[model samples]
Target: MPPQLVLASGGGWGAAPKMENGQPVPGEFVVPNGVPVGSVAYFQVGNPNPSYVITTVTWDGGTDIKGYMSGTPTSAPAKKQEVLTGVAKNQTSYTFVVKAEAKNYTVRADVQYANGAKGWVTVEFASVRPTTTLAVPEDKVGFQATGDTNTHNVAGLVQAIFFQATATTHQHGGSFIFMQLVKSARVESAYFENNKLVKEYIENDRSIPNGEDFDGKLHDDFLNRLAYLHIYDGNIMYGWHLMPGRSMPVPAAPPGGTPDPPMMFDDPKSQVPLDWIGNAFTSSFSTYLMYKPQSGVWVALNQIDWSVSQAATRTGPGGTWEALTLPAPTQVSQPSTPNGMAAFPTWVNFTSNFINDQLNPWRPLD
Candidate 1:
């Protein structure tokens, strides 16, 4: 009786998990039927029929396929193909490593049974590279209070300071920026909130609830060690209330100093620096932003003017505020990643201080 060939272990069938940076990324084992380029997939074959003894196995691939018979699967294959002979009489199984280098690959295995009976099987899969979609950097434009051609505006503020807004008009106020990456059937959406990460999803695995943080745990493998956001030629401010008549509580006059003047809602001097956001204040104004998403650590080029609005309010300071960047809207560049990870230009991490050009040093500029 002839032996029936079957997959013994590892990623079976069409999915070939590749070795990335000498390591296997999680969720690669479950990818339906495709392989990411520059990755290696291991396949073990078993002989179901005891009557036939598996003696030798040979692997062949297309020009771009790097195939191996022995060694670690965590690294790329050294050569194009491999052949192994002398499989002790009744060897149960044999494993082969194949690296995807191009768009398509057809890996064929010629199995030699101890009886000299020859049989072969071929597995075809595609090598796909993930596409990264990054939002273009633009100027944060326009500010409209309630009943002024805008929605409630709270969500806008939240969108600005946290999530990546889909529309260009909604891009303001965000604390972090990101790009969506899709590879094969997997769609990865990751970001940082409060400089911390929470969850990640793989290949239509959308179990994570909405309005939740999507921080990819495999960020280091895809992005550079450092990323930067450039804020230049504009202004940013924070205030207590979004309404017309907001004011902060005034203390009594000092021993010899008169009490500070009241902060009028319309006064340009009414606002303060961005430190009003609490603990994140120092980190926010400095070159080093308080974020480290799985993608990478982020730095900033803060050339914007900063101010804060008065503390007093008509409604309890409920994340509401009257703030604006005017005359010239604050222009912000998108967060940067390595060219190898995504298609992006080299980012210059320096800023002009009106005196000269300087690489925004890694310290607080507030």
Candidate 2:
């Protein structure tokens, strides 16, 4: 009788492993009919007659972090054994089971017979990459543009802020002014991000819960990074932030000090002056801003006007950040809110919006 080595029970006709509604069934073995024609979690190899009672099976874990092979099984519900050698050779089919991680495998399996003849097979577990849901960036259900009209999405936000009641309307500085400036700022360049990176970012962030995918949230949220642009008019500036889909955090008192240009370059953190941006009591130079998510608060990194001199250490302790250029920002009185945060019409939101104009000796104002 001819010795045989073939996949026995994968995603085939006879038997199949359990499956979740939308999820692919795990542990699919190989089958003779050749549909999938490959093995996933398990395989079988036996002699046509008694001459070759497939004795042992060995495999390389490959991408799998770790795995183990159990004793041979001739019947249903194969019992776990320390080694395949102890199993009876008279059985018709010898089954080798493998449990792996990450779904894709390039395992190489070797089979040995009682007669010492050896044969091996290489198989791959090509399964679909699982898709998951993510949190939505926009509040479609309860976000109102003003007091009456409801709004969502970027375009809606642009229009809302564009026509939004002037600075004092929201009882704060002009969100509209900043909005208009950004619109005219000329998108010198923007951050490049894809859904994958955004998804990874969302997943890594504890604040963001697991949800759905392929929707607009991932794309929208990433756009909120607000760190991608270089603008110029009379001054050379590099800035970022649209302020469309983000929370409002009270900006810190504008950075107040003298304009010692050399002072800002002292600390690597302060090397690029936030005061130069918009971190000012009032300013004719670049404005700078920072965001701290842990406390859910935004801080104006360096608060300074042109009159104030540059010191050092602009950005507070946190993660990476970005910036954008803005015209001189006017301060508005914050309302008497219980939480001291967002009580005023602050020009900058709680974002890592950085602006580099005269401050950046590297890219000085044009």
Each candidate's number of clashing pairs is 14, 43
Off by over 4 Å in 1: 1-4, 8-33, 36-40, 62-102, 134-366
- Compared with the true structure, the alpha-carbon lDDT of candidate 2 equals 0.24
Per-residue lDDT tens digits for candidate 2, residues 128-237, read: 21111111113321122333321211111211111111111111111111110110111111121442111101111111113211111111011232221222223322
The superposed Cα distance between candidate 1 and the true structure at residue 345, in angstroms, equals 16
Q: What are the models' TM-scores?
A: 0.27, 0.22
Per-prediction CA RMSD (Å): 22.9, 25.0
List per-prediction Cα lDDT, in the order shown: 0.28, 0.24
